[model samples]
Target: MSADQRKSPTEPQRGNRPPAHGRRRILITGASSGLGAQLARIWADDGRDLALCARRLPELERLRDELLDRHPHSVVHVYQLDVSDAEATERVVERAVVDLGGLDRVVAGAGIGMGARVGSGHADVNRRVLTTNVIGTWNTAEAAIRHFWDRQDGHLVIISSMAALRGFGGAMAAYSTSKAAIATLGESLRSSLARRPITVSTIFPGNIDTAINAGNPDKKWSVPLEVGTAQLAAAIEAEPASAYVPRRPWAYVAPIMRVAPLSVVRRLVG
Candidate 1:
């Protein structure tokens, strides 16, 4: 298929969808912690059935237990899948769709970040970070899109970052570029899916205090995970194709970067 063409769903829709009043079924990757975990909690409170995936089995199990305890009637299934592994990711995503009876929404929350000076030849770090943040997110979104196409009524949320708004500086070369790729990928998917019954939401979040940033000592640069996740959740509910989380000073950064000369950004970021 052409890059602009929308791909149809791969499987037949299964089970009877609940009444309009019933909760949405959502599958979220990287659900073991941070914004992913927060999204799971907020959605479960609304009675949504959940299929959560992450590499951390213990954390995923904990989230599953918590969700079940909070919403006794809701079904929360946890899968140990790393989105970077294409075959394994596809298999587990297929299972999540079947077990959840089909998905009404998907949040591709799996990603990684790294910063240690690009030319310093942090080869291993750069490679691993790109694999996790870019390709891993791609894998998750591709799987989710297939399921959404079959259901013909669902939203795909792609979690990018404010760093994506502009190519960052200092040691963040690889990390910023990877996130920018995800943001652009989501934007393209949004256009392709517009004619279809499916919706694509691209979220650009600012400095969320997730484990992804745990290595960074600059705590002042980060905001509470809730601040970012809450904004993202609201955008998901609105079903917008693109959003800038927190929607304030952070949102302003994107336009500034877009309009400002690259030299200015380089000076500031450097």
Candidate 2:
């Protein structure tokens, strides 16, 4: 709720967490590609054990083998998870926690960027986006935070977006809406759990040419995949209530987007 809750370039606030390079157990949803996959690589290289989940079991296995091949000592388990299925999400998360012996962090990173114009008669696309991005995230959060609640210790990170600072129209409508909801959800969780050791963080990533953002209008300015996720891993390590990946411009740009005139917004984003 306070302005300081959003991290600044220097001295970003952190929570009770493992040491910067400590080896710990982490679980990540949507680990098949893009941000999730890259984050796995970054952390694996740091010697952390991981539980990687996504709809694509094959890709998960491939990533698991690759990480294991590179870091022979790290333990990586892959689970086929479709976070939209609440029951399955709960089951798989519990199982993954069991497999990993325990969980130290969970990243609810599963999401889709599909959308349709409000009046375009493509209700199905809009529904899919809301269900996958919003509901799917909620399901993952529900299961993960429940586990953390039991121990009164853990970190939950939601991958939000800079798009959340505004309500985009056209193909970005539902995606932006979902990200806005995620930001608010992370803030609410952080507030509710303030008295506990559990740390809830929200990461607002800038444009990257990931599968979910094929239609991003700002794609040309996208940070390279490895560069963006490396920044993401650093921000997550800090465990801020909220953060912008590659904080230089976004740490400044996000605030302006929140209050800028719609005309200016249209010219900049649309």
Best by lDDT: 2
> In candidate 1, where is summed lDDT lowest over 10 consecutive residues?
1-10
- Candidate closest to the true structure, highest TM-score: 2
Candidate 2 lDDT over 1-270, as tens digits, reads: 222222111222222333355428799999999999999998877767788999999899789778766755456778899999999999988987777777899999999887889989998999888898899999998999999999778999999998899988888898899999988999989889999999999999987658877655555357788988888999999888999987867888777888998677767644
Query: How big is the RMSD of model 1?
Result: 8.0
lDDT digits (tens) for residues 51-84 of candidate 1: 8899999899878777665555556778898899
Residue pairs in clash, model 2:
none
Quote the lDDT for 151 in model 2: 78
Runs in model 2 deviating more than 4 A are: 1-23, 217-220
lDDT of 1: 0.77
